[model samples]
Target: MTQKQDGDPKSLSAEEAKAEFLALQERLRAADIAYHQEDAPVISDAEYDADKRRYAALVAAFPELEKDATQLNSVGAPAASGFGKVSHAVPMLSLGNAFEDEDVADFARSIRKYLGLSVQDPLAFTAEPKIDGLSLSLRYEDGVLVQAATRGDGSVGENVTENARTIADIPEQIAGAPRILEVRGEVYMSHDAFAALNQRQQERGGKVFANPRNAAAGSLRQLDAEITRSRPLQFFAYSWGELSEPLADAQIEAINRLRSLGFSTNPLTRLCSSLEEMIDHYRSIEAQRATLGYDIDGVVYKVNDLSLQGRLGFRSTTPRWAIAHKFPAELAWTRLEAIDIQVGRTGALSPVARLAPVTVGGVVVSNATLHNEDYIAGRDSKGAEIRGGKDIRVGDWVQIYRAGDVIPKVADVDLSKRPESAEPYSFPHVCPECQSPAIREEGDAVRRCSGGLICPAQAIEKLKHFVSRGAFDIEGLGNKQVEQFYADEWIREPGDIFTLRERFGSGLQQLKNREGWGEKSAANLFDAIDEKRTVPFAKFIFALGIRHVGEVAGKDLALHYGEWSALTSALDAARAAALAHRAADEAEDAERIAAEAEGRRARISETRAAAIKACGVPNEAQAAWDDLVGTDGVGPILALSLSDALANPEERAAIDRLADHLNIVPPDAPAAESPVSGKTVVFTGTLEQMTRAEAKARAEALGAKVSGSVSKKTDILVAGPGAGSKATKAAELGIKVLDEAGWLELIG
Candidate 1:
């Protein structure tokens, strides 16, 4: 048998696969929240898509992961709590991505296979410029606009009817239309409007958007309709969410009908009869990307025949009838001036490339992330050669690639242009800010500072994160303010924010008497701080800045544990078990390592047997570890990290100190009385009545846990047409199987 490659997902141990899957889930979920709910994307389109593809591959390599793959089915973050939730009659599904010409061809092939079309049979498709903007759905009844919503979580969205009515391109009334129609499209900002808005924001000392997409989203999602009206936003109607009558039997005609009915549509749309035509259109749109005066990340291809689209059906998160052909990342070459290291909140030392100022993807870049020391050494963590193993050096020419607002990255280094005096720069072995020894652990790619709380860089960054918008969100407390307070020794940690007023309110060094402060502004800051004295438990967890515990994990943990006492109880139980196991495992490890050091092969071999006996914990203690790991999103890796963070003397003290000053409230509970409440439900094959996303949202609303696969834990399986192995497995496991009709009746 041929062996798989070293880094292949298929070759990963069962434990490794589980750990990596959970991490990928966290990464994707965080990116989704940032992109959809926050209106700010943390990673580039390419990186997000790559992570998604990796998730898909891992699931393929190890099918057991599917049962825990709820993240794969998520469309976007849930609708913001600020607005009323509007459930879409027909879910607004996301389109799958196609990055290469082959992917496009495969998409066509899959469509043909689903339709049973012969190779000679002509297949028609509609190709349009995929606008880089926010998705919106406008509902009209009797030619009068009644409601509008953002495509939040694909199924339920935020009601933004008043804001949508203000866009000039979106007509409030149409002359002739069906009694009920839900026109769907994008809300975007033109390049000119984006620049002007940024300039205005700067002049007014307000937040500046990173890109036109962010600007448009921020403008449209404003609670005040007057604020949205004042912003120069535009709309383009390209699809429909729910319809009373069919506009046309084909995709192109439907778009035309939308345009005729007084809605702006993308003019670059074209009908393609073959896969070659689709690729050509994609290329053509990409060529015009820079000159279009607006952002278009890619081209979207859709099945031309509406009936064929209906037949193609939908996946959990995307429609099978459509795919987006994304463009490659924009790249430019620049001279590498220097390499610097920056310590993060986690004490990880990250290398940064200082480049001669050059524009990449319309953004001037003087710096790019070097990822870690291995990357600077021209090798990946696995020692695989990258960029032909040509190490990056100072004064060498490097190619920087940037995708939109994401940080620019050094893509390649040109050895031919290297200066005579250029050197392979030595990565620092200590923290640059504090001179603390940086230690690189086994299997870890980056060296991290060992100074812990004493490292000023780590302390400052953690403090900054504590007050960020997603965390405590203290008003008038930005990064600069946090740094200034830290440098002055007035505030050192998160808890210090709560003590500031008590410490300096009446003294000559009062915050009001400080530079950049006045009595009114100071009072407002204190009021903001006081208002945040009662923080939601999820925010508090995220504000702790624990490694591997992000906003998503915080929400997961909050949902799992419900209250502070229960969470702490679980942590304590797990910690005791973890300590017992660690001590035993370390003793066994020491014996085995010592045996190997003495070249005692037989003794080393015997340690494997001894390790098993040594590492075993009491059943009750083992159950504690299992209980924490069983939390839907937390795996062995994150569970251990969370346990260690709680076990650390200093970190635990800091957390408790911070908690003492705040009243932590639990998140709103899900519906608990529904039939599917607390039960695991799985959906397989194609549902005839509604899309997969809609079914999932409905099930979740009833407090059911919807999984992607059938297993012993699955309480119910909603099987539909073409149900295969999952259906068989559900039957084998005696899972309650329901057809589409039965599922609908039960839910009703």
Candidate 2:
């Protein structure tokens, strides 16, 4: 058997592993959302990959965590906020990964099965090098380039038409093209250009990028087209998005057509009609990878025939006909030198490890992101030290690894050779940069600075989140614009975004006269701002950018409270209940302390009603807390977060001011005619006709609330065969119980 690494997940009990798994999941979710939606990546790619592996290891130890959640569920954010956001006619998507030859074979077999063909049946394919650069889409209407966009979250992208025009490989106009054509491609910088540019930048005392891909992306997204023009960037088209008519019957033909229309296409793209041929092409591409002059991470294989690709269809996030076969990662050993904290655009204080330089997978690395203080300590979610209590520390030998990413990842700590002088690294209690108190809320993996607007790092991030696509989603106000406005002091907070027109509408500081702003663009931005004056309740709630309150939680809160007035009322009650709960805890603590001093016994246990009466907490407030906690998809943690946010005077006032800027529309009312509308449902035991998941979905679609447990509020209990205590409890409460058939009949 192969020996396992030092960070043995087996050290933890199943419960501890699960808890850590969930906490890691949440932390990654925030980082991913920032990357995909906010145009801000809090963690490096290496750290993201490492955490994903860790998440998978925990699930492997306990498969139940898979049902709990996926490590990173989706590539596209629900809404993407970036510069001049344009919705893609056809979404740019990620491809399923393939590392082993068996995975590739399985991919071919699955495609055949879906197409009702035998495994031996001839299925033509196209293999192309997967460019390690930013994805770009160039739109042409009537043979002229109209718009260019970068793949932001697949659903929407940032408009970069003027910047794209600076690239020599991108054609301004293509003769004899489709009436409406969208050419999808990669924008990259050659190794020579990257080296030369970095040298020139270093000489000029300007910013220098880490890699060619980073340089390419930075150059392309520049607000000033002159800067982009000065950068040597190239475009290579290998796919098409929206089209007025099909370019060709086959994928290869379409690629050739694009090449003929003056767009650069990958010369290495080849047609491989069989599985063996596809593998051969992959090998051929891998052999010449170093000499290619540009970086390519893997080879992508897709069905050659356009018709077959259409028939193969797409999953929610990826295409069934296409897969990216990646290269293997390399591993090496290194030493941990020091631990440092880096604050992200948000207030998240992420711990980073300074490592003794080591080469892994042909890349040299000095630092690796530790993710959070817990990761640095090798602690579980409950603060229990795992990994056999041998945490990562300075002067310890560590193992680092990487695939094709720029940064290397810390894989395992070598406590066997740890220095005797090494002590437990104490995570900072305050923000290192801002000197603000760093608060690690219960169940949160990372600690955050509580400085809010006073913290410069967080002030802009909050504004960015406020206007993010999932939030207010104001078009034309992306990262660069937000940063510029923040630096110029044109906008200081979320409310200032709404007052742009009022401040600069027709004055001497008219937006139209600004360096890059034309009359049309300025008016468009103001119009976009005005258009979002009335936002949906869920979006408005999400715009507040409260901690632990993501898009999903916002919707839950919106659905539960329905209206802002109702939500405020609930918050008030929940806050009162929280105060009462705190008082009761103090009383219990005082009783214990006094009893110890006097050497007398003190009564601690009390009935719920009795405690509420003793603490002078209103029964209505307690009931409100209970109701908020019981809301579908919401629990105590989320409820407490909402309550705490409203309790803070500064946050409350900011939220109120933002609310005043927009009309907060309540959630859509459920259908009043459905038999189970507005009723709470509980499902128990083995369902026959439908899975438990299906039943819950159907109930929800019909306006019925499906709860996990039965309570006094439960109106109906759908008990299947082998029903248990839930059914018994339902009967005791005089609640209506139904079989699977009865449930179906009632809904019908």
Candidate 3:
């Protein structure tokens, strides 16, 4: 019995099987603890599922022995808490999963029958990826994320406060002032990061993660935050459990609200007005699963209308309003033309596929991601020797398919499809954008340019990024416009944008004299530029387009660095220090130059540290800087962007010119509004002051723009529960993420 309990296959007697059943319960419980509370898991889903199924069968056969089988009735353990715990306004529940298309169709049929509607009836369903990850219940008070919890059982679970904070995707607060709200969703690991992490673990002689789902579960469960911090995690919100006020009249609106609040809701999500569209979406997603960068076993279909969903009610673990449409796990073949490396704002080198133009679904896809180097050189299923053109080279036909939309990756290469003359791809030794030498950072597979802001490609991309909706938001200047300007010698640097009015004034005047460009239209365009001139410090920082800087980061930078003049001085000093540290390393004075190097690195990477250092004297601190740094959530990335921008002479001049007219003034410090002021307000997340619908209505009533995401035109991002990506991007762009309290303080 003891041997059976310990997973010894040899001990397969009936009595031993009974004992093993009890042990299985304990194992499952422990696994659940690791998964739900800590945001990590110890075993693969297949292994866990096998054990669970085996235990279930044993308990069913031996009801007498089932008395000790705690799996059936035991409530889950509570998570270790770092935040104040609060009961959810509504209980967040899990969905029943399906493993086949037929099962999904059956579910759809059942839903129709339950509602007494014929299959031909105009029933609408929204199909989205069923994300496999940890579930979280976010609670908002006055539009702030006051508490977040793990979904333990159907009813209760452990508190994972500190663990949640490590997830940058989760927002700490939302905008708008609703009384209460609760949102629920899954948090998981990205495939690339998961593979990288597992590789590191294997190299270190540690256990390897079987998949991204397991990796996510494992990362979240670590008792030490430092461990969790090392893992790359992402989140996607699909539903809400409860709210103080009805968020939206429709389920689609609710999801939209969640997205606006800063959560990474699936952008592919669509609202279905008819069953055909719903089924089409399900089939379409099933077909395109291989292109999505995550693993998803199935698509979760839900009713589009909140009222209709409410009318349907729910079962024990699953909602009656929703069903999972499972896609078959299969791979498909496609040709890979060439591999191109793209450097992100964070300097992560991603391999992109230049494929033979193929139509998958409605879109023509000419590119696919190659993932990492190891994938390119790997073999296939048939054991027929997977070969690239030269060696995982261009002109190789590849196979790909998704278990789900969570991670889309290359599965195999067809040697026969390789072109006879295809050449082996040689990765550039230098940054493609800049002439600077590229170096792989410590323990990282991706090589990055050491050129910093000197690279033309990097600079152009940064400028475009800065002008993006979440950043400086120069309306007429979009990606194409910026690219054209950069290519045509219209703008050499970010600061050159400020001088555009002087350079293009004649162009504008001439245009007004032409057929299409009226004086009023040209004046409006100029006015738009003028509007962006006196931008806020955070926006200004984001507009500089530094590597890794986003809206949230931009805000953090602005608050820390304060005034432009002071920040520039600090960056110059920091740049000098970074140079010194590099020199010290080359000279082998690693220990002797430790302090000097330390000071330099801190300025480069440490946002708060550098700001504090920069703000050495009382007189050196500007009121805005002091207040900015003192703000609750400001941090490092923001500080760096601010410092860099301030250091640029061009930026300084741009600021001076803009300040001459469009001086950035803080929003009327949380004050009462005029009855009829045509004001603008942007919502950042879930609102606790009012329901999302109510908030939008109120904004419209007050003559404000109710937008989907943060843009230059957006007045606010009325955020509520589970705000994630939007918030981060907003910060990167220097847009504000106001809490309900702040919003109410201002509006009231």
Candidate 4:
């Protein structure tokens, strides 16, 4: 076994550490399930300790790896079946990890940074022993225990109220508490109780639990409440989920309040004023780990102030307010078999590494991600060799480790055991699914297939994207139905989705007679499809599935254009400008070239001015290219891609056909009864009545165009306290100008 130096993750290369970290995460997660859910022993306690330590050292060494790595502080596996599921109001978030003393200091520093506090300022933290057991959430309504649940996947949990009522430590009712309260804590069995239960199991020739944590989890998950009552399960209130009213201002006070409410709160939790004190508390807890009646894996540190915690908020899956410093992991070795390329919805080819099955941590991992070709070639994105240029090849012995819930990766390859037939794998340069030419553009590590509309893979992917939750979101037209339609020739394009009832509703082979379709179901599907005919401008744009144009970009384009016709006209003008510019560049004669260039420039300038006038703003395309690219969040690359797609004759025809059948609504007009409604209004300087954003929103809501700058087409300019250049421009353009009060009166 290779022992990692304390606090030094740099001992291994970046690739090595990442692979080991991912493997350790998976291993630890499986170990957690076996120890906490299944009541089984896959590895010895010492081995589990070693795996956890190594995993922590790797994380501390390379902090950047933490972003993609599995969460280090998650307690148990997902809740087992046999109970109904309950959706939690506030998500049950997990904590981050702190392995060493420096890590603890960094945690404190991060909290200070998030809260904008200085080093000298006092920031208290509450330190508590991280209990090793199943997590339970008890809900109380009007001071009565109404519902109890186990944290399933953080968002939902299994309803275990009957099982929870059996635990003596749990309170059936609490006086002087909020009307709605959810107390979250750990449920565990003491060491002595576990020993006694295991002794009884052995005498009866039944399955004996390997540990108390496992015993408690197995006992509490029993389908029969009477069986759970027979077990010696205990509950310790340490935190909470949802509450109708505030418990207290600080963390320590809340725990004390839980204890006062007849809940068995952990007695060892302490408040520390400094990092030194917190570390001292951690050491004390570790020293008393064996003597503690219940099992504890590590110490947890949370920001003492509830307001500071609120400000800190959460990461994707964990709260930034707290961290659990864990112990080390177990390790194993496996052989690399082959590497495979899998194309995603956007046509980006991702590499997957196939490996010989090996158990590390506790689960069998047969595959890991090579990330990209660069990773397989033993180089970083910048072409720098990693791990001394140790490229992974087929038939090489590789070390693997698991931590929490992270996917396993190839840590280090054993060159000594490399097979004689091992060869360097070549990444594919073509789309394996469609036989299309895949290109890797500059500044991009990913290679994407360029056969848009023609490639079946790209077509199907786009169709799936169109019906996604954020896109068209049409009910009864899920991915499977879309796939079946596409395969059966019933639908080849998005436009076909709208024309389904027209083409096949009265035919002999009607949709009602299909395998999954009945008369009511077919009618429902048609009704659902028809109901989406008049979609919002943003939703329509997003449903197009143009590359790089996500939900945000779609809304941006919609707001910028205001109407579908305007957007199409702008794109057409842009296409014309591109052609003119190209023609000017290709002219060989100096005089002719100069003439063409001048004409092109004039055409572009004219188009821009026309766009500005129509839109009642100063945003004019220097060229058609500038108009699309200038929109917020729509960069040159995305703009070019959109224009190119629109420029294609076949694509344009299909879009036109789709547009013909649908009524694409323009941007909403402001409400009536206001004089400035439907007019282009510009706001300048500071508004005393409201913020600038509020003023603009109010104008737009009243069916007025809120422009940023004054132009000839601008109907009115609302000048405020500090009005300057814009006001003068409005006057020069002979546009009407109003003070803040005057504008408000006019609107009223």
Candidate 5:
């Protein structure tokens, strides 16, 4: 019988303790399932793991918990009979874990020692983040997702077909036929999405998820396919289960094949030529972990050579070919003395958690990001603080730690550690820079200064966003260049970009006479600028730099609005609509009681309607906007940003000036009767004829806008092999879905 720990009730019998342990196991397992399989976590990973470890300890202390029902050795129950069980075409396995650098080096030594290779012998590996999420086996016959199963019991698992289809990162079909492929990988959530989801959950009074891994698992396990569809779950393939015929000689080659097939493989994956290089890769990942926006426990080192992996294959549960070098979890307790608001590059007032220094993962932590006042204050009925700690009052002890070591956040406050003389913090009601009233836009979490077109911080960020890849994608103008220009007073706003030639003309001529900026390079730059001038409506929209707008959104906006002139006019109106929309939607009929109801409602409704309508492209002018949005893979946030950029009067004038400076001709329209002229095409499935990215670019060259998803009005769906639900949906909606050959024929 499992014995209870010191905190257990003294009256409890031995059998009762065993029963409680078993009950705890079941409860925790259910929570894990909710986390790993469902993409909705009921508890935090820390809480779940802690409970699991406690249960394990109890079992160890009292042998009663070791009975068949409570033991950890039970194979992951029986495979759910939803799909026929197929023996792993190639066995899906786990990796051995190492908590520190020494452990990682030890793993490397073992690999070398086991293979009887000398210290000088070449040993290569492909290192990727050991993502914390559910593991699955994806089976493909000739490059299509035929079946996918959970990594239940290392043997068989529930067949989650309908749910898996919702994941955007998973490929339904692969390019170039590879007889069979059984890929293994972790499904996870991006940090941005995870935070957004948690926020939504908290707003709705639902149990908040602790981390992305748990959220991903819980989302994936949702019995309702529609529920799964709503979650933001992404999958990254790290290895394969089986291959009837090997596609690559090395692990790197195999991964390249996967990337070519439209799967979003980790770009950071590297081929370490030696053990030292492998260690270098691990260190690099560790440094970058916090910035990656995904959680990784450690780096997974694999034997790159396929032949070597085969020779080193198979342990009962894990493979000898790969090992996991886990970085220690970054968690620490710090005394929170106060919270301060800092102005962001965008004029956003960000709440910073100030704390007494503490150490975690060898880094001293004094300040962590609270993201916004709303986050620190906690939403209440009247936008007041609900947690009694408004704006993180001074002298409160705060817990500080890095989530995945990428985001430093204040997890909690230790009221007991707070000083008796401490006072509640008062949040600033005015902008720290321009003294403008800082207004929290309806439905927005961050408060911002309304000094648009004037705020230096906002201007700089806008300009930066303008030249960003997601925006105008201006070459030769990166962050450093933007900052230099801003400091030198060469540019103030996004519109100032067009004035670059004027400011640089004399200087550029001198530079041309100097070493590097010769005629060729200068000419190349001018040519690049000219090329950008006749920008696609979509790209122009993305360059606008709007809050809550991103590249994809920009395309949607451009596709919706069509012309620069129309988009600007619409966005001007949309800005008004946005305020009204939020005021109306923030809560029930409370819109009536909103202090600034009339002003807010009128402004927001106008802005939002324009923005939404801009996104939808409801008419011919809109269709012109939609044409830009239709550019394959454009998203909503980008679309909004693009709309805002073009809408700005200063930016428009700058474009006009740039247009005059270059005397550049607009892009020539496609020839009449051309197959792709002015058409909207969305590509899906496995594209064997060409790389998916290449195909989209080619389509753009032919004047056909490529869209990401199938819509009722889509002119065509470029259906490659393994065309699944999208193709079927297209057929149902009467949209044409073309295979690779069909597409080639059309373009020809």
Candidate 6:
């Protein structure tokens, strides 16, 4: 009869466990749908697994509380509606996870207890890399591949036979396979392939995939076979589903048989006779993961002996003979020294958790993303209460972890270690950099400064971005130089960069006489700036640092508008649209205010009239706004942000001044003679010989319009490794798909 602590599932009472159990079920179900159906993961794998583990722990602690439809018994969500339904011969069960070495030891001990084996008895286990990919089952009849299905909801799956047939690694005809065999494997994209596919996706104005696993899943489940053919998908056979005959006596032998039958198997698979050896092998695999060309989140250890495995048979959803040893989350506990708000180029006031120096996965981490105000207020992106509704405060002990080894995030807070003197952190209503009012729009997690380019922080950041490697990339004009110039008011904006030689070259306080600047170095800097004065349309668009406009988006905008004036006009129109929307909203508010008070009616009416006047847009302007919104990859959210930035008179004037200083070249139309020329082209996945920027530049030079996404409008899709949703969509649209070599040949 232990009483439950607020957030501790371990200390939960029976009643508390029941409530938490129901909540977890709903949360997990939503997560499953988001991951399996939409291919958009709302939470990290570590967070998802933690939730599942907590539910299991609660159920284990109170066995009677377990329900029939518990999340633990499920594999994945049901098959998406479009695909043909497939009934799995054997349920594709998920493995129980082991997050620690002790968990691995417990798994071995549990097996020993179930089998009633002596401690001294040798328990051989086969350890293999746990590929982060889509689980696929290939059914063969008389050594010929007959059907293939995805592991949807364990028992029922989506039939992807035609799509599976296109995968080169999946044999159409096995030479020595059993009469009826169901080879279970993972359909995955290599790291290089995934990169190339993303690159192609960006180039074509297609949806960029989140990770290799998502890419593989999205690719393999394509409705069109041709799309699957274009994707760089590979499979690794690890287990069997239903077999007419026993392939081998042991797991290692069975894997060898699969390899012999022309199936790709993980080369890191090893047999371990002891727990120590098994754990050691897992460590070895973990160490090689970065260099493995594919993504592996963890390692799987299964009993080698088929007899022993059968003896320790099935649990509700997992096999007792096997356990997935997950790589330990790169987490560290540290005191939150302070919470600082950093204004981005887009004017997003991002909260950063300044932590006491702590090591996470061997890297010294002193800062972690608070994400937004909601996160700081102990709420999720959806505004749902998190961490038992405990807001993070300065001087609190918090757990930080790196998600995918890229972004450091605050995982959990140790409430017991929170300082008594610490008060709840109050996020500022104004931008710290420029004292501008920071407003959080409805449904937006981030609170952004509305100052636009007028904010010193935003302006300086835009200047930094303008001079960045992917933009102007002027030599001798690095971040330090940009910062120094901005601080000294020598270069307050991007336009100033182009006029620096004229303004500062012969001045009393010349750049040559400044600290760290010799006459030759200053001359070289000026020369570099001069060289970049005549910038490409794409580069110029990107240098503007518009909100939500990344390199790909900039390229898309450039391709769509063609000329600087056209692009600027479209942006202005979009800005006018936004202004009109805001005016209408204000007028409505004024009407309400006038109704509330008679004295304020005249003032309110005057304001409303002004707002309505601002809202007025001509047919041409409306059409420009329509074009801006309709552009591929430039959705409403991005369009709104871009419009707002450009609508600000100060920002628009700054951009116009910058444009005047630079000779902005219009985008070249695709070459008429080239096969891919004039085609709306998309590049997905990784390129071997050149970077994505170089490929995009080359494609643009050849007169191809590089888009960020795929649509019916896309004429050609240049697919590389890890081509996911876009490639599939292209096939559905009957768009032409080409590999890197094909693209090169066509361009030549």
Candidate 3 residue lDDT tens string, 1-748: 1111123333343334543553455456555545554444443343344455566566666654443444543333343333334454455665554555555667677767665677668777777887777677777778777666766544654456677777888887888625777778888876678778978998999878656776786676666778887789878887776667887888788888788888889877877766567667877886777678776766788887777676566543456788766555444567776788875443445567776765432223455555444335442111122333224678788665434222234545677777888776666667776668877532233466767556766667667666654456665666777777787687766667766667777567653664545787766666767777677876765555554343444544455556665555555555533333333333333332454556643222343334344535343333433443333233222333344555567655655554555455332332335532355565655565455545555555454546666666444554567788877777777766677776666556
Candidate with maximal lDDT: 1
Please rank every candidate by TM-score, starting with the best.
1, 2, 4, 6, 5, 3
Cα lDDT, all candidates: 0.81, 0.77, 0.58, 0.73, 0.62, 0.77
**Ten contiguous residues minimizing lDDT sum, candidate 3:** 1-10
Model 4 accuracy (lDDT, Cα)? 0.73
Local error of candidate 4 at residue 155 (angstroms): 12
Would you give me the overall lDDT of model 2?
A: 0.77
Candidate maximizing TM-score: 1
Off by over 4 Å in 2: 1-18, 33-83, 102-124, 272-280, 330-335, 342-349, 355-366, 378-390, 395-399, 403-407, 412-421, 428-539, 551-650, 661-748
RMSD of each: 6.1, 8.6, 22.6, 12.5, 21.5, 19.8
Error of 4 at 469 (Å): 3.5
RMSD of 5: 21.5
lDDT of 2 at 571: 79
Q: Give the lDDT of residue 599 in candidate 3.
A: 66
Write candidate 2's Cα lDDT for 338-425 as tens digits.
9888765457887778888876644557877666676677765556555555678888898876655445556677877989999988
Per-residue lDDT of 466-502 in model 1, one digit per residue for the tens?
8866678777888899998998998888998998878
Residue 81 in candidate 1, Cα distance off native in Å:
13
Per-residue lDDT tens digits for candidate 4, residues 1-748, read 3222223567554444654564455446545655543445444444455566677667788865543334355444444545687889987776666767898999998778656678999999999999878788999999999999987657767888999999999989899999999999999988889889989999999888756776787888888999899999999999998999989999999999999999998878999999999999999888887698777767899999998777566654677799997644446798888877766556777677787887653345676656567667777544556656788898888876544223455556788999888888788889988888888753345677877777777788778767754566677888799888888888778899889888875542578788998888888788888988888888788788775555556767898899888888898777755444333322312333354567743343454345434443322333655767657556544565577778889878888887887888776653565677778999998888755655776676566878787888799999998999999998888999999999989888
Model 6 lDDT tens row, 1-748: 0011124555543334554554455446546656765565654567567768777777788664442223665567666545787999888988999989999999999878666678998889999999888899999999899899998768888899999999999999988778999999999998889889989999999978766777888898788889889899999999999989999999999999999999999999999999999989988988887788888889999999997775565664788799998876667799999998888776778777888987664345677767567667876543457776778899999987753423356778899998889998899999998888998754344677988766988878778778765567787887789889988899988888888878875542578788998888888888888888899898888778775555556767888889988876777656666666556555755565566576543454466567757767677766776778677556544566677767778878888899998888988764486666677899998776555656776676566778889998898898998999999999999999999998888887
For each predicted model, how many residue pairs clash, with residues at least 3 apart or on different chains? 0, 0, 67, 23, 75, 26
